[model samples]
Target chain A: MVGPHHAIKWLVFALCLTIGSAHAADPEALDREIDQLKSDVAALSQTLFDIEESVLHPADTQVAVFLALKDKEGLELDSIELYLDGSPVSSHLYTDRERESLRQGGIQRLYIGNLPHGGHQLKAVLTARSANERFIRREVRHQFRKRPGESRIQMTLDASAPDYEPVVSFQEWK
Target chain B: MQGLNNRMTFKRWALAVLFSAAGVSAYAQTGHPELDRGLAQFALGAGNGALALRYTQNAETEQDYLLRAKALLKTGGQSEAVRLLDALIEGDYYRGEAAFLKSSLVSNDQEERRRLLQIAAQKGHGEVKQQASYQLAEMARTNGRPDTAGKILASMDTGYWAALGYMNIAADYGSRDLNPSRALISLRVAMAMAEEDPNKERGEALKAQLLVRAGLLAYESEDYDKAITFLEKVRLDSYSTPQGLYLHGLALTGKGKHRDAMQSWHRAKKYPLAFSGVAESWLGTGRGYDLTGYLGQAGEAFLSASATYESERVTLRKLADMVREKGAYAALLADAGETRAEWFLADSRMLTQPRSAYLLRFMENAGNQAAVHRVKELDSMLARMERQEHTLKVLTSVLDERLANSASDNKPALGHVRTEIESISARLIAARQNATPGSSSVETIRHLAQTLKDLETSTDRFDKRLHKRDQRLRVLHQKASDALEKLDHRKRKATDVLRKANAALDQKFLAYIDQESERMLVALERAEQQIAHLYEYLALQNLGGGSQ
Candidate 1:
């Protein structure tokens, strides 16, 4: 049996030791937890950014031109040259598959590019062989406005005219 | 004595005239015996063999040999005809005509045909040359080289045959090339040539046919005004077929004359022909109805047409069955080589039956669906895979970029840093555990506690950030998964709708057939009963006739 004052002093010393050990453990454990959390956050952010990049396009102004031939008869297409404001943008000598696809009523994407929003001119020169085996050249020019968003120009080979020669016409898709 | 001398001179002159006339008649007979024999056999309506024999027997000229070859060909002696034509071609006087005739006999060799036609056109005389040129132009038109045909026709002499050739070329261009304007030009030239030709009745008939053809071509080319003009010029009395009437209606419809168009269709339907069904379908679909959006009237019209076809088919089948039951009649028809009539009857019955026609149309629809169903299914599956793949690719890139950034930062990897921090923690714990209550300074304890508190606060902040990002990621993953589920649901629903629609169509077709078959059976029973009663009455009358 001990005296009351001596017992209280012993209790206080025990409590202090327990508190000191607890404090010592807390910092090291917290540091490890924080390092893990930081790593996780960085990884998640990167994942989110990559997802956005893949699914979304970068903000830009662009114009696309599509070409098609309707009633492509009596005309054997050889090549097509696309021009933007009097400057050549795309020149393609048609491959067999491409020509066949066009003849089968497939649309070809002639050009796609970023352009400042304003009025623009497009010109396309078509070269083909006629039924008489003579080389025929035709050119079509069209004026269009490129708005803030994407603009589409469609070039059609219309051969329903009286002469049965392919008539190239450009129309803006609204 | 002078009167007697005058009488004798008159008698002598009469005798001389009589002998001269007899000699002239004899010369006419022997001089062109081949022509006379050919004409006589033709007049008697003799068979080709008899005509050929006569011409061959009397072959004294190049013309006679040509006529014999023509007769041989008519008699189906193609080899003998070709041999005779070869012989005739060796003679310069008959070469062109012989070559022209041979061209008609040959088949399956376009080059040879063209060469022969060219030779005939270039060297044949008079009408034969013109006819050969016409044939060459026609051949070119048939070969899908309309421009060549046009050129050939243009080079021909101005005549009725040339005009006919132009008309044929115009018809070819109209039907094949779908160039009505060019066709119209050709027609105008043909019409002018016909007007100038001496055969008035034939020229008028040709003009009428050309006008009708021009109208149809104009309608096809969507030149409705021109079509109306040309169609109006067509004499309805002789040139108006059901097809013509329908085309006229179409032109009228194009010109905004709806009432007139309806009149034309009604007139067309009155013909009771195959095209009448088509006209009815068009009228039902076009007038006062949206064909695409509202299919009720169109369906009714199609059902009606189908019923008509089914009835016709059943009637023909019954007739064929009746004919088969009469074996004697069938054998007689077979022996006569008239089995084509039986076949035609059978075909007519099948096609005209409404139930059969409906089933045919339904089967056609089913076939079309089957053709595209697999393609659609595959496309749906591919799209789903593409979406999933894209999501995974994005996730992979995100992870890759994070790793790259970490490496480029020249900082320790998260795992390594974690290990370092843990090691530091262990060392600190060891140090804390080793601390002697009397030896450790208060300052060292306080600094250690502050560092611990700071790390805890930083760790709490980092954990909050991580929790936020993790929640975002979970939401995105859920969204992608939900989108995939929705797409799958949509695909299933679309497939179900297609299946149900097809099933409904099949059910309708079956119901129609059952109803039509029942009605036909009832009618057949009534007809059999009536026939049996009539036969009994006739037998009784025949038995009682002598006593009465």
Candidate 2:
């Protein structure tokens, strides 16, 4: 009969070899799985961010300020409250609501007289209260000027995100 | 036989003498045809043929009696004049004046009046002809035939006579129905005649006065241009009274040279309304200083303008407006009394909340009240304007809706669609069978469509350009960032290299400079020592030489 010690050593050697191979393979496989997971996580995070931006932002974050003088139509709107450097311009604001508030955004309609042929602007924060639970918010720094007659204002927004498309827009009476 | 015949002849002669005396007495006592008839009846009643014959002879000899009869008839003694005229016509004497005068006095009974006027016209005498025309005009007036009277008056040729007849005819029309043109023509002719001949038997001054009257009549008749010409003719520059100045200013203002008008007004302003101040102001001069736009001066002007007029008068509105337009602070402040305040408040109220006089119950009761009168008239005008505005809005909207609905409904042949397209041309052609005139619906639609197409094309082009620009900018930005990073790296390497080169060069050059400086110092020191020795030797030599 072969010697038991030799047999045991051989078996042990095999066991050691298998365990060593497993150990080597385990670390490599775990590293590869971790790398895959990191890529997937990055992709998922980007997708989530894009979805949130589209759903919540509703508008471009970087707004271009403009000055505009709408025809008499501008005056007929529900309220035209202009805030300049966080203060109300008396000429543009119907009336000051309170010290705490810069202007009364939802004041009654103003009867603005005929607008002389010229351009004007108001840098402002616009808040449109909705019939629903959500409040529409716009941080606008609009910069537009009027011409002699009827003219259209085309606004464009710039942003840094890769998937974000710069939005262009205009306003018209309904 | 001789005694009887002679006695009878004596009786006849005596009877004839007695009848002649009675006839003479009767003719002396009587006056006209009636007097002659009475004398004849007296002679006949006395049973004396010789007396009757004598009375007839006596009546024939009385020329003054016939003249008295003509005078009575000519003076519109209608019955007496007609009786005398008839009796005179029966006679073989000339009776033109009596026939004419009697015929001119016929009553309004058309047949009789025409017969009388015709007879008078037949005479061909100028005065008789005028009287005939006058009678005809009277008939016309009495018969409600003023237009006929005007026509007749217009046709008359002789200036003075025609003018006289026209004046009478115009009077028949009364002031309300008066044809001022006819009146003016007549007056002008009369005036010229009076001015030229002025019947110097009457007076030249009277003629001039007549001219003035004619000019005033023309001026009041709304013939402003003619008034100007006529008044200027009579105007004497030397005459400086309010009336003269007023007329002068009126003429100038009517001519519409406002500056000259203002000058006249200014000169005339020294006079009050009772003195002609109003006419001056209307010509637009001599208003208050307050009305002049000079703040300090306007106060005085406004005060004067206001003071010149009656305080309770409605004309104060014009003065108030003048002061307001002057924009003088003091003038406005001073003018804002209770009355002015009420006016302002009323105006403000009207401006803020428009009143519809038609809807107000008080309006019906306001027959003569000032505000009521004004509001009623103004409300009607405003209502008409509002109606026009509403109509325009409706028309424009209808056109718009027609166009929109047409485009959506795909009805290409719709009248409104055609109208919409036609509107762009602004040529208000009458609408075709189905089209409304002045509606350019078709043209409008075509223009809008073209504009929308252009917008689409432009938007696409703009989008492409912007996208390209954005991409180019981003790329350029990235390249700049990379170039900056490379430059930073190159700067670091150059700085390190430069620092090492500078350190080395500094050490070498500094050491060399120091060494050169040290060598010079040492050489100088040695040379100095050598020089000192030489000098000492020389000194010794010199001393030895000096000692020698």
Write down the TM-score of every candidate: 0.37, 0.26
Predicted candidate 2 versus true structure: per-residue lDDT over B1-548, tens digit per residue: 76466445544543453455343222132223333343333333332222233233334322322443443332222353355455443333324455565564554456865766665555536656665766676677667787876666555445344545554554443365454666565555555544433234232333333444455555666556666665555433222234444555555655555456556566655543422223335324422221333334333443344444333133324333443453221222233421221221222222222111101211222221222222222223234334433433443444344334423233333445346545633432332334544578755544445544444444344444444543433443343344334434434433333333323323332333344334334433443443354457568978999999
Listed in order, the DockQ scores are 0.01, 0.00
**How do the residues B1-548 of candidate 1 rate in per-residue lDDT, one tens digit apiece?**
65456445434543443354343111122123533443423312332233233334434455555665665554334565686676666554677888898887665788888888888888798778988999888887777787888888888777678889988877666766745777788888987877766666566656666777777788878889888887777554332344566777778877777667766766665543322234342443235132233335434434444455456547545543443453322222333343222121223333444333333333334433332232233333334445544665565555444434433243234346556656776777777777776665544654555555444444444445444544544555554445445445544544443343333323343443455456445444443443354457558868899678
Residue runs of model 1 more than 4 Å from their true location after superposition: A1-174, B1-48, B125-127, B142-145, B157-164, B171-179, B191-209, B275-310, B313-548
True contacts kept of each: 0.01, 0.00
**Candidate that would win on DockQ:** 1
What are the interface RMSDs of all the models? 44.9, 63.1
lDDT of 1 at A90: 95
